[model samples]
Target: MSEYKATYLVVGGGIAGVTCVESLAILHPEESLIILTASSLIKNVSNVSFYAKTIVKFDVHDTEATSLHKIHPNLNIVYDSLKHLDTTNKVAVTESGIQINYNLVCICTGGIPRLISDSRKCKRILGIRDTESVQEFQEKLKNGRKMVIVGNGGIASEIVHATRGIQKIWVIRDDYISATFVDPGAAEFLQDTLKSNIEKNDSPVLRRHIFSEEDTLVSLNKNLKSAALGPDWYRKLENTRNETGEQELEIIYKVEVESVIEREDTEFPLDVKLSNGKTVQCDFVISATGVEPAVSFTWDIEPKFGKDGGLAVNELQQTSIKDVFAAGDVACASWEHAPHWFQLRLWTQARQMGSMAAKAMHSKITNEEVLQDFCFELFTHCTNLFGYRVVLLGKYNGQGLDQNYEILLRMTRGHEYIKFVLKDGRLQGAILIGETDLEEMCENLILDQIDLTLFGDDILNPDIDIDDYFD
Candidate 1:
């Protein structure tokens, strides 16, 4: 067995792991570090443009792990899967039989999609997460006449919007569309766009920032991990080919997939039974239910887990185990969350958490104190839903506030939708759909804690330039 040593070691090559190693390399140039990943590529953030303190736009690129060697001479990249982590001895053993002794270790293993069906052995049922899953779905979609998408999150939202030509049936647990991101008003606006065939500006979809390898990654094992797809993963690849001129869209609300049964006598091989006592035969099932932290490798170390099945981490991103830290989707913040800030598994948080975790690790080693990042002050999300720019700020859904908040809304069919959540006459959260150009001002208002009792409903008036009012 070969043995190696590094002053710092990180597992997983997703945005979190890559950002952590890059930050450490910059902060401690004299120290040597290693990045261990199961995948052949590492996620890199490029073309970043910050609109506010925490709200930013960026693109993700999948780069070859070997090419990262040029960034820092001391940064070593190991292409191996972690099998066991010994927190007491500070040793990590990989599937390749390499034991790595590390001074400090950060777990950035990301997450694995929670499968809806127990029969993962079946090729007909699929879960979307990495490029491999998308490819598998694409191959199946070629001859697929019908597909049942189960879930009401970003993944399912994008899939329904991107996939045309197929008879798409969505199984949403919530009554409204994109319920994870928007409320009913915004959902209605998006739903209207989804039903209308008014051609979207396909030009913007062409301006993608994805980079992939010619040779796909070989699965290391059954538990091989990969980074979740970032924003516009669907826009980059549009598979719109249907034999029928009119695409059929159906929504089964407030229900879930009860069971998926395979049948041999039908043209469609699968029959999906719903909780609402309905069974539909479809070509395949797309399970975007959600994800669980990829922390199975840490069973030996036994890091404290949160209710969400993620490794419980302090504000410093340190796990319960000494000298072990976790970031990205794998780490769930155990500290009391800031009023405006709540955790949502997104690319933005992954990058931020990874960078902050590096600083926390460095400060611990140097005996220095570091303040919590301002990014944690408020939750800001920017993404596209139904070909519309969607921005969510602070308590977008009035989460944790109970019935104490008030809402103000303004919507124009086929144009824009805006909603503001106010508590005690202060802007607590806001959702801006379409090119509202109000995200910056809304974010600032929420951050400044300015009272807007006098403005009332006028805050959303189209004639009033909200940016000028804030300035």
Candidate 2:
């Protein structure tokens, strides 16, 4: 096996790994950095701008790993799959027999979609994670009339919203939709858009390539799992309804999958038995059942792991094993997180953690005191659901605040929905749907912790400009 040396090394070419290597390159231009990724395409964060303190906007580009040479000269992208990592000696071995010894290493392997059933065992069920999975789904969806979706996260939510003219039966374990992001009220508001009778012809969905695709999927060893799809992966694809009939969408709430039986007797290929005592016979099944971190590389040196199975890292993003660090979905923060900042495996957090981990490593190398990033002060996310703009800040849905919080909500049927969570007259969280233009204001409110007891119910009044009132 040929051995190489690198000053900084990153594994997994998703947003987290790319961000870490880029930051390292920028921070120490003289040093050489290497990235080992399984996928041919690497996700890079571009057009970055901080709209607010923690609220930032950026576009994710899935570029060919080879083309990354144009972005940074010192940074090198290696198209190889990692087989084992030896944190004891600070060395990593790839499946191709290329060994690398690095002074500092960061694992950004991200996570893989946790399917309801094992992929190898079930040919009829597939989990949406990469372009290839989506392609497979599209081919099956072409002739599919009835489909079953298992899970209620972002991927499942997007899949249900984008697909049309097909009988979609969403199997959710929660009573409300989008249990990961929105509250029951917001779910209800967004659920209306999925109605078959609702006319949504005026707005055309934009389907364009955000990044230059130079390479296709590469054949990796069975040990290496593919990285999770980045942001806008669903929007870029063509989601059109081909079936012509009374299309219906049914929700089977508060149920779990009991078993998946491949039946040759039925017209459909598979029969899915649910916990609710119903058998769903459909063309195929979609498992967006969430993801577990892809951290098998740590098998050589078992680091402290969190409950979610991610490597446990401190506030500085350092793993229990020295010289080895982790970020993105692969790392779980074990430190006392800020009251508002909680862990969610989102693109924004991946970028933040990656950049922060780079800083932490740089500080260790240079023996400099680095302050923690302020982004951790609050939780912020911007996404769209059913053609509606959505912004979530801080403890948006009262998350950990429990019953100690009071909520103020405002709605403008089919146009906008706003909710603000206040605790002891101080702003705790806020959710804005449909271009409310209040993300910045609410972010500041949550950070500043100003008393809002005086405003009372006028806080969410439609006519009241909350920004001006605060000013």
Candidate 3:
């Protein structure tokens, strides 16, 4: 590749990286920018967000209480790989071995699929690594096919639900899925709901609760959350403890991907392997893998660690490197309110981090005379599950809720409403699995950041006036 130069260097081309460049161009249009990716820009993975999801719905609105629907927008992406970097002279080289100079650099190389093992036996899934691969995989699903997506996180389950009318599917979870987010009963609530639906449909389906390498990570420390004092039920549940629950009970081995392969009698087939030593034969395979911050540029600049040699920054998004800014998935987040400082990695956090970093970068322009917190606001998220639209805000640890909290249960005429709130009244987090209108109420409650302390603590009693908050 021919050598190029830029005043600002933005690596990777995912949502975070793209947002980073857009922010920079908005802030420093006069500065030359370099966005380097290793492959075709358009084909690189991007995030498939429930937040960005669109749908068609007729609207009758004058002004207030307007209806919102899907609005599709054309997106453009570009990519070129980086091969070298010289932090001292602030010059970098690309994979094509082309050299370029920069004034400021932002490393957002995104993440690689953190598959526990590199075995080709298991069907590779798109967790958080790439968005394009997932879109392609979804396209393959639209072409009429069956697939077995392994893993139990929100991503896998979301994919399972999205492909519902289209693809015949089986989702295997060693233990409970998303045990981290929902409580045991809640996870069980979800597991039972999905499993029963899958069984009722009689689509070729299987769920395993036997064992997994992920279970081994049950004790490992998360970057953001620090380990708290007492024991947590979800942790044990995630570890697959002996519990009185009907979990498809299929003891299929992750290594048993070979066994399922023979079951796929289809003439057009996509081979799939699992970490459990099992083999699956499907028309396609998708792993809902994850991504990490890209910090290859920072590695050589200073002291580094296991991966993403990123310099630590406070909440303001300031890095160890002066005037050098970082944001989104690229910024290493510290735990704020809890037993531990768990690493914060999510879409909302990334975007918030990016925007905050942009603000800080601008602050450098005359800048602040006083020493600020050097902080970036962390994020929380809301999502949809099949017919159920779920919203999770703030940090949700595996531990059960404190006694001061109340579970608001409401069945209005027929709509079921269940909302959880902290004793202090802030909306720690909420889930809306049913009652579509309740999501609106919940979103409003969260958005307004109201205090429920004045109201009765018995939210599950279903008599509280939620309209007041919205009003």
Candidate 4:
């Protein structure tokens, strides 16, 4: 057993943990900062660009954990899994029997893939989350003739678009695809693009860089899970295909996977029973249902958890436990949220929360007043779906708003789709699909709360030049 001490400790090597430690190193270079992570690889965010006040675009790189030490001499990276957190004593014990004493600690362990109920019973059921699991899925896909994907989230969508020359059976409980992010109209618009991509058999040409010895070492520990893969993780994977150049996709809507039964005679080897009384025979099933917070370590005093099974946190990212905080997917914002802002477990929120938590922690230590981050005032996200850039601002899907709210839409079929949610003639939310380039304008409108009752539906008119009109 060994003992170490730090002024600040952060757990997990994902975006949130890295961001927190990096921010701390920048803010307090004289203080000792330690990051203990289960994974040897850390997610590094670079080339960051803000599309709006809160909307951001950046590149995520899975680099060696030691690379951070090189950048911040005050930051120490420890490769170990958290076994216990003695919050009362301000100490953390690792699975390897190493103990860390800290003045303050932040948990950004992220989340684990929410597997199907019967996932443990069958080896054919795979849940894609970390690097190792994705590699396992890729290996299985090489010989897989058919696959059943069970989810309607971003992960499922990415898998559907990335794989080629294989028959894909997409099973979803929702009527429309990508229900988690977009509305029905946007979902409908994306259908053509999804089909076109499948027909074209477009495959990602980029390949992941070779893994280092440290990365391989972390993967060997099956019990210790790494951080969730980044947004563009699918691009780095090999585009597996079958012997024939035929790629087919079948979407089973409004159904759930009831059970998975092992087949004795069929070549597929597994039979998937659906809630809609349909059975699918496929080589494997990908469970992209979602994720649960990765809070496996025990604590002296258990922290409050939200309905989503994440550590409940206040506006300052502080958990109920004293001197303890949480960020990223493992954290649930229990405080009253801004009207247009809500929490979503994405890399964007993880980075924002991590950076905010660092400032909050610094304030707590220095007894300095700190305000909540401006990023929390509005909800913004930038992602790509079906090869089209998708930007979501505010209540993009009109979430939480009553039926009194109105919607204005302007769609160009296969080219672009724009939707605006209005309440009392003010821009409450907006969704911009394709290369609309209206993100900044729409975001400003939502934030400014400028009334446009007089403009009416002409707000979306292409010839009107709303940007100039607003100016």
TM values, all candidates: 0.91, 0.90, 0.64, 0.92
1 against 2, candidate with superior lDDT:
1
Better model by TM-score, 1 or 3? 1
Q: Which ten residues in a row have the lowest lDDT in candidate 1?
A: 204-213
Off by over 4 Å in 4: 197-228, 240-246
lDDT of 4 by residue, 1-471 (tens): 888899999999999999999898888778899999988888999889888778897878888988887757877778899999999899999999999999999999999888887899898899988777888988877878899998887778888887887789999887788877787778887887655443343331211121222332111121211225566778766854544544489999989999999988987888999998989899999998777899999988988998778999999999999999999999999999999998888888999999999999898888899999999999998888877888989987666664456778887767788888888788888888988879889988999999999987678877777889766
TM-score-sorted candidate list, best first: 4, 1, 2, 3
For residue 16, model 2's alpha carbon misses the true position, in angstroms, by 0.4
Report lDDT (Cα) of residue 119, candidate 2. 56
lDDT of 2 by residue, 1-471 (tens): 788788899998888888888788778778878889988888887777666778876777677887767656867667788888887788899989899989999999998888886456888898898767888888877778888998877778878887766789999877888777777777887897876555543332211111111111111111222235555667654646644534378999989888898888889888899998999899889988777898765357678998778899998898998898899988888889898888887888899999999999888889999977999889887766777877889877666663445667777657788888778888888888897888888988899898988887777766667789766
Comparison by lDDT, 3 against 4, better one: 4
Residue 425 alpha-carbon offset, candidate 3, angstroms: 6.6
Q: For candidate 2, give the lDDT of residue 179.
A: 74
Predictions in order: lDDT: 0.80, 0.78, 0.44, 0.83
Provide the global lDDT of candidate 3 against the true structure: 0.44
Report RMSD (Å) for each prediction in the order shown.
Answer: 8.4, 8.6, 11.3, 9.2
What's model 1's lDDT at 225? 21
Tell me how candidate 1 scores on lDDT: 0.80
Clashes found in each candidate (C-alpha, N, C closer than 3 A):
0, 0, 59, 0
Q: In model 1, what are the clashing residue pairs, if there are any?
A: none
